[model samples]
Each structure stands twice: as structure tokens, then as C-alpha cells.
Target: MSHSTKNSHLSTTVANLKPSGIRRFFDLAANMDNVISLGVGEPDFVTPWNVIEASYHSLEQGYTAYTANAGMIELRQEISNYLKHRYFVDYNPDNQVIVTVGASQGIDLALRALINPGEEVIVIEPGFVSYAPAVTLAGGDPIIINTKPEHEFKLQPEQIEDAISEKTKAIILCSPNNPTGSVLTKEELIKIAAVIEKHDLIVLSDEIYAELTYDEDFTSFAFIKGMKERTILISGFSKAFAMTGWRLGYATGPREIIEAMVKIHQYTMMCAPTMAQHGALEALKNGQKSVLDMKKSYRQRRNFVVNSLKEMGLDCHLPGGAFYVFPSIKSTGLSSEEFAEQLLRKERVAVVPGNVFGSTGEGYIRCSYAASLKQLDEAMKRIKKFINEL
Candidate 1:
């Protein structure tokens, strides 16, 4: 095929899509032998027996048909109730929630629904990689504001205020953040709330890790004063309940925004999996104790990995939540990508480079603790050897 002919059929939008840096690095690590990957942000535990049982039961009951575009009413109601019980936020199942294919889909739907062409949206740097591209795909421009390491990679009120303009349409707030694992405290969220409220901007709040807070209670943006009304709360069973493969997640917000999201959802994906919805509903009905169990283990693993990193001469933020430790690699005078690649290739320890997330991630690497303590110990040993050889 000629080069011009091969390119002629591609959508200009997708033709220009940059492949995910995370996936690119991951692919490299995957081919390497004897690699102990601490790179993926996924739980190592099996999905709880109860949740698995629920899915099986749903399948047995022949609940495999396509669900309503917004999702099953029962799951939506359960999600609404769970949010109120877990975060103390009022939500109407009928009008406030839409189940989707994991929190990723929820994020995409929110971006597509809320952003207008060429409008700018603010994303905190050293954050998740998906937010910017999703906004860009929606024909919106992404404005990234770098969060300071001194501030623990937090999105400051001043940063948000300074980033705002007449063209700004939305902002992404990820608490218990990926890569950094920092949780936004209530007071911190209140500061952000003030900024968004002042500008009347919509908030695409990704709280998928909401149930994994350590050292402090989880704070939902939906619970912040004046934020719930304007915030699209994206969450799922992935982090909290080890249900990543289930591909069930949801977003809750104003009815108008949700309806708009459903418009996109109906055209792209008719509905999330029916079996997953049923299982998710059962999870909402019976998964509280499981959440606590996982969180407890994660907290223990967090302490083990963070302390080991410090002992290995790495400066790491003692992240309050999520299952990751973002450690500085500046002393090695290596870029984050180089550090990650060298560690994986030489020491067989695979961690994600900070630069994979955003420019602010330049000198850090993210190590996920969502593995066994034994695995973590081995990973730490390999990492130590990798550092010592420098």
C-alpha cells in the first residue's frame, strides 16, 4: 500500500492521536524477561468471592442482554445510595447517575458532553495521562498547571485561578490521585471549590480511588460545599473492590449534564455490561466490608513500600491514599523515563516514569504497591541494587 493511500481513510482526529506513553513503556517491559512489574496501577488481589459470585449468578439468570443506555435502574439506585452512605452526598438515582464502561468511559463521556470546540479545560499536572487527551479529543484544548512537589503535587487554588480564562470550560480534579497517590483534603477541596464556583466551571472529578484513602478519610468533591451540583463524580469498583476487569464504573452529576453524556454514550456504547451492572449492584449491596479489607492491606503495603524506598535513598512523598509511591529519581541525574527504563532493563524492576503522566513528572517514578508484600520486598531489593549500581 502506498503511504498516501494508507493515510487517506483515517480520521484526522484519530490519525493524530498520540499513543499512550504508559502503554508504550509497558509494552517494552512486557517483552523483557524476569521483570518484576510494579508499573501497573491495579490491585493484585483476586476480585472478592462475593462479587464474583454475583456476576456468576447474574449470568445464570440470563442477565446478559443489553441494558438501558444509562444503565440498570437498580444499579443506578444502588450507586446513588452508596454514594450517600459512603460520602454523605445526596443523589437521585433516576436523574443523577449513569453507569459506563469503567471510570475511563465516564471521564470521556463527561468531556464530550461538557466541552465545546476550542474551549480550554484545566488539568493538574503530575496527574493521570488520560485527562488531557480526552479533553483534546472532545475538540477542547487542555491547559495544564504544574503542581509543586513542595505542595505534595496538589492543585492549588491559586493555580486554578491563574489558569482560568473566558475560554476555560472545565477542570479535572483527581483525588487519591493516580501516579502521585495524593488525596485532596477537605480544606484543600474547599479552596478548589471556591475557584470553580467563582468561575462557574464544571468539575470532572475522578474519584475512582475514593475508597482507598490512608492516613486520612476519603473526601469526595461531591461532598464539598457547592461542588456536588457542579461536579461530575466518576468512580468505580476497580480500585476499591478489585473489579477492574468487570469494566463497570459510573458518573453522577446534574441531570442535564448526565443526559448530555448519555447522548454520547448511546451513540458510542449502548450500555455497560449487563452482567457487570448486576454484579456491581450486588457489590453496592454487600461490598462495604470488602472495601475495608482491601484498604487495610493496601495501607500496610503502602507503609512497607514507602519505608523501603526511603531506606533505598529515594525521596518519596508519603502519599495519603491510593496504592502508589511516586519517588524522586533526581539524584541519579536521570530523566524519569531513563530511570524507569534502566531499572526495568537492568534490575528487572518495572515502575512507571513520572514523565509518562505529564512534564511535572520529569524526575519521579511511580511504584504501585498493589502487589503482595513478598513481591514488594523483592521489588525493593531489585530497586536498591539498580540504584546502587548508578
Candidate 2:
């Protein structure tokens, strides 16, 4: 008998999962001296003082214990109000919302609550890294629908139609998408809405970057005539409010689905951190100006980074939203992984390999503009020098 079978009884699903391509690059750069990283898709901004102070105020008021399993009613109400005012989507705070430990936990809760074994969920790539793995871990099979660069990486209605099968249960949508920074236009989403209605599929819309759009206004999937009932709307303060460390996020959907996810969350997560929930409430209620300030800065950085890459002979799309620009490295005659690896090794400037998102991402690399212009300028110079040498 093999020693592995006898001694290590890990779940085969988890054991076989590939580690995150983004984190692998991050880890490699961590030990190196003076590596300028455009790898992780995280905000470089600190949480606004008012939001941080709110958490402190909560602690001062002895709000240390867990609140309701669905999270503090006040926080949920604020989320409800914000959703309504900002996106015109009304979700009942009392029954249709549950606070989570960041958008990631909300995503996992939704998948685990809904996915049955052998079911398939469609995940668009190059997309966020967590979508497919979360489905697999929930006992669902992931079906990748490769969104093409020429199409600006938006999931097309026809692609959705082609990928749907009897076993297909849901589709994940992220706009102002990570890795590519493409936002789905309202017209584009309407077409997807039609397909969703035809297939009777559930939609897990990751709108965590909802407030970070640079050009077009964001359209919530729930706003699509009849999507509210079939969509799990997940969002948070992490990006817009620069409250990533606060770890507060929330999900809104049909009451039944929200109830199911809340039940799982009650036993596992209990509630999002009490202080963080209070902080999130404050962000929803009073953080608009701060959000705008950060968005403006991100926009400037985006223009600079995108233009610089194009000038350096890299083909980069002007990202419509979010903070990343995915540029093709095909002309460099290097595979995406090879390009990212050699760039990091030679220039000490770390970027994530686009192939990590999926095979459609094979000839590109994702660069984040969340860093300061000085850092971006320095990194761009290094990248250009490296490419020129090649």
C-alpha cells in the first residue's frame, strides 16, 4: 500500500486544486530585494480615517461580541439603503441580505449553499481567480467560458447559451473585472439577462468593484428587469472604501437564497467581525467623498499605466474600469508564464502571468495601477528596458 493513501487523508478535490497564480508570483517577489510588484489586485490606499475611527468607536462601546447570524440589522439596512440609492436595487435588509467576512466568504457561502454534486457552474475567464475553485470546492464542476480580448473580455450572450447544459446551475459575473479591468455595459448585461432567463440559471454577480468604474456607469445585474430573484449580488467596502483589512462584505438575493446562505454562515462564520460591520455601516452612510477621491486617483493612474505600456510597444487595452490593464506579450515571443517569470527575475518587477486566469489568457500579463505614479513610472522604465533587451 502507498504511504500517501494510508497517512494523508485529504479531500481529493482540495488536494488537486492549483494554487493561485497571482499569489505564486507574489510569494516569489516577497523574498527578493526591491521588487516592484504589480501582481496582487489589492488597493494601495489606506482605509479612510472616518471608517477606521468608526470601528474604534464600536470597540469603545463594547461591541465586541458577535451580532445576529445575518449580521447587525443596522449594517444590513445601510447596505440596503446604499444599494437602493446607488444602483436602484432594493433588497430587504431583514431577509435578503447577510454580512460576510469580505466578498470572498460571501461567494463561498452562496456556492456551498446552492451547488449540488455533479452540477456545473460557468465561470468567465480571464476573470477573478477564486470563482472556479470556489465552485469546485462546493462540489460543483466548473465550466470555463473564455471571454476574448477582442470582445473586451465581456461574457457574450451566445457564449452563455452555448455553454449551458441540463446540469448547468449558475454563472459567475465580475465587472470592472480583475486581471482585465473590463466593465460590462448595460446593453451587454441585458443580453446576458435574456440568456439567464431562458436557461433558468442563477447569477453570482461579483460587483465588489462596482464603485471603481472609470468610464461607463455600472449596471447591477439585479437591475435587469427580472434578475433580482435569480441573482446573488455580492459586494463590499474593500475596494471603494479602501477597507480591505476590515473584511466586511455582504450578499443580497431572493429571501430564500439569502436565508440558505445565512444558515451556512451562522454555523461557520457566525457573523462578520462586529467592529468591521460597524465600520462598513459608516462607510455606506458617510464615505462617498472618500470613495470619489480614491476613484479619481485610480483613474489617473490607469491612464498613465495604460498609455505607458502602449508607448513601450505593448498592446494594452484602455481598461474601462477597475485598476488592472491586461497587455499582450505575444510580440515579446514569450509565453505568459515565461514573460512574467523572466521579467520578475531580470527586472525585479513582478507581474502576474495572464495564463493563470485560464488558457485564453496565455499570451498576456496583468498589471495593476493601484500603486503610486512614481512606482508605476519606475516599474515601466524597468519593463521597457527589459523588453528592449529582448
Candidate 3:
């Protein structure tokens, strides 16, 4: 019953995991007055009205029960069709697709299903905070490949080749990546695919921000000629459809891998929420315009944030997609954590310290441009003032 005794009862894997740096700053901002948060990666838009109505309608029709383990057949078909139409990838809805609680769950499922004890999964860094830990919890050692700012944080094929070893089994990739907003182009992917093919490795491609790319066509890794069999495509309605609270996402890949993930899902999660599934169905059917409109707004915000940061002497990359801009704060001679904390305390503006994503992020901070233009303008002014005073 003692504190130390309780700690001993916890799994070493769970106990040793560091708390999310994003949430720590979010909590600090939550306790402060008049704080403008540019930390969280969630969209500022509400879910489309038709999606909301459909979810409510599902309940009225006495559909308040569990769906099939893989999800409703119609929703799966739509997911299949959407991918084929939008990104030119084909998946058999019957066995190749699974509706998940979120893309986060899809990541967890893929890792658990693919990894054996002591195997290694390559994780590209300045990446999602969950990735390395998820590999660890799945009993795989995470081999980190740190992408650099000089290269715009894009992962190179040589980097992948350098990290692979006899025990390496998989890799996690995010285009329009979280925190960095750096999108890998099709050419870049073709090169990375070569390395994956050479190693005969599986890839967990997180495309949650696929719809948010501003200046280029979004390419699915599975759409590449020979990569589909080795790629598990994970995506959701959270970013594009503005449905974060819905907690609905899905994955599609080779039937065998999907079957393995579904086996775990049935025992652990059973199925994704029924109403959220219904809402997601409506989103895929009628949410294109809303997605485009939101993408436009986010694109504008991305430009504003990048310009503002550069004007104030910060080194910022012009993000090609997603609602985040990772700007280097090293010029200010402050650590990422120190800059984030001081800005929150002095300017009442909340941003996440980039080091939490990985060591490569140590001198930067991630600022989400998902807020209203007015709020972004004000946050920029406060940030400028804070830098000037320092």
C-alpha cells in the first residue's frame, strides 16, 4: 500500500514512460487566465452538421449496439471506395479493412501484431510522441532515426538503410507529420520504399493529415507499385472532418495483417463506437466541401504563423500540410522547454516544447495554427513582444 510498493506493482514499461510534454504544457495553460493555446494539434472547426445529424439519427433508429468486429459492412465499403477514388489504392472491405477507435489505436494494433519480443521497429524522429513508446509497449525496441532541420525534417532513404539491422521488423511513418508539418513527396517516398523493400519490412503509414496538404497532391504509400502488400494505411476523420471527439479511424492492408489486428481488436476493444461509426459514414459520404474549406483556412493560418515567426528572427520552415509549424527557437538562446514555459508565463501563449517529440527537436517549439486568424495575430504579437524583451 505504500507509494514505493505500488510503484513496484506497475509494469516496468508503463512506469518508465515519460509523461507527454504536450499535455504538461496544456495543463499549465489550462490553469492560467486569458491564455491563447497554440499547442494542441486539434482542428478549430466543428464537425459538419450532417455528420452530427446522422449520428443522432442512428440512435433514434435503435442502433445503439455493437457493430461487427471489423465495423459495418457499408462503412467499410465506403472506406474502401474513398481510398480508391481519392488516393488510387484498393482494399477489399470484407477482410482488408478494420474500423478502429482512432488512428492511434491502429498504430498500437499494428505494432502489437507485427512485433515479437526484442525485435526492432525504426521510428523517425521529431515524430509523433506516441510512436516510440507504442513500439516499446508492444515489446519491440525502437530504433530512432533523427531527421534534421537542414533537410526540412524529411527522412532520407539512406537514413532508413543505416538504421536497419537483423532484428528490425517495421517502421512508422507520418506524412504531413505531427508537430513538424513536413510532408514527404511521392519521389521521396519512392526512395524510402526501396529501402523498405530491400529489408522486407512492414510500414505503418499514418495519413491522418492527408487531406490538409496545401500545395501538392497527397499520395498514399500503398498506391506505390509494390508497397501495398507491405503497408498498413491508417487514417481517420479527426483532422479533415473536424471530428476528434468521435474517436473513429480505420486501417487497411494485406488481409493477413488486418486479420491479426482484428483479432486483437475483438478481444481488447470489440469495435469502435457505433454512433461515431455512423457519423464517420456521413462524413465520408458528404464531407468533401467542409474538408476543403477547413484546409483553406488552415493553409492561410500556416502562412501567417510562418511569416510572423520569420519576421521576428526565428527560423521557421513553411509547413506544407497539417495545422502545425515547428519553428526553431535556438536563436533566442533558450532551450525548447525554457522558451515554451517563459512564453506561457509572460505572454500567456501556450506552445509545446519540441524536444518532447525527440532529441532532434530540442531547440525548437511547435505552434499549432488551428486557432482563428484573430487569435493567431494576437498570439504572434505576444510572441514578438516576448522575444524582444528577452
- Give all candidates' CA lDDT scores: 0.90, 0.92, 0.94
TM-scores, all candidates, are 0.97, 0.98, 0.98
Ranked by lDDT, top first: 3, 2, 1
lDDT of 3: 0.94
Give the number of the best model, judged by lDDT.
Answer: 3
User: With candidate 1 superimposed using the best TM-score fit, by how many Å does residue 244's alpha carbon deviate from the native?
Assistant: 0.8
lDDT of 3 by residue, 1-390 (tens): 232436387877777777787899988999999999999889988899999999999999999999999999999999999999999999999999999999999999999999999999999999999999999999999999999999999999999989999999999999989989999999999999998999999999999999999989999999887999999999998999999999999999999999999999999999999999999999999999999999989988889889999999999989888899999999999999999999999999999999999999999999999999999999999999999999
lDDT of 1 by residue, 1-390 (tens): 332335388766666767788887789888988888898888998888888899899899888899889999999999988889879998888878999999999999999998889999999889898999899899999999999899999888999888989999999989998889999999999988988899999999999999899888888998988888899999998989899999989999999999999999999999999988888888889988988998999999999998998998989989999999999989999999899888888898888999988999999999999989998999999989888989
What are the per-residue Cα lDDT tens digits for candidate 2 across 195-289?
99999999999999999998879999999999999999999988889888888899999999999999999889888899999888888889999
Off by over 4 Å in 3: 1-7
**Selected candidate, larger lDDT, 1 vs 2:** 2
User: Where is model 3 poorest over a 10-residue stretch in terms of lDDT?
Assistant: 1-10
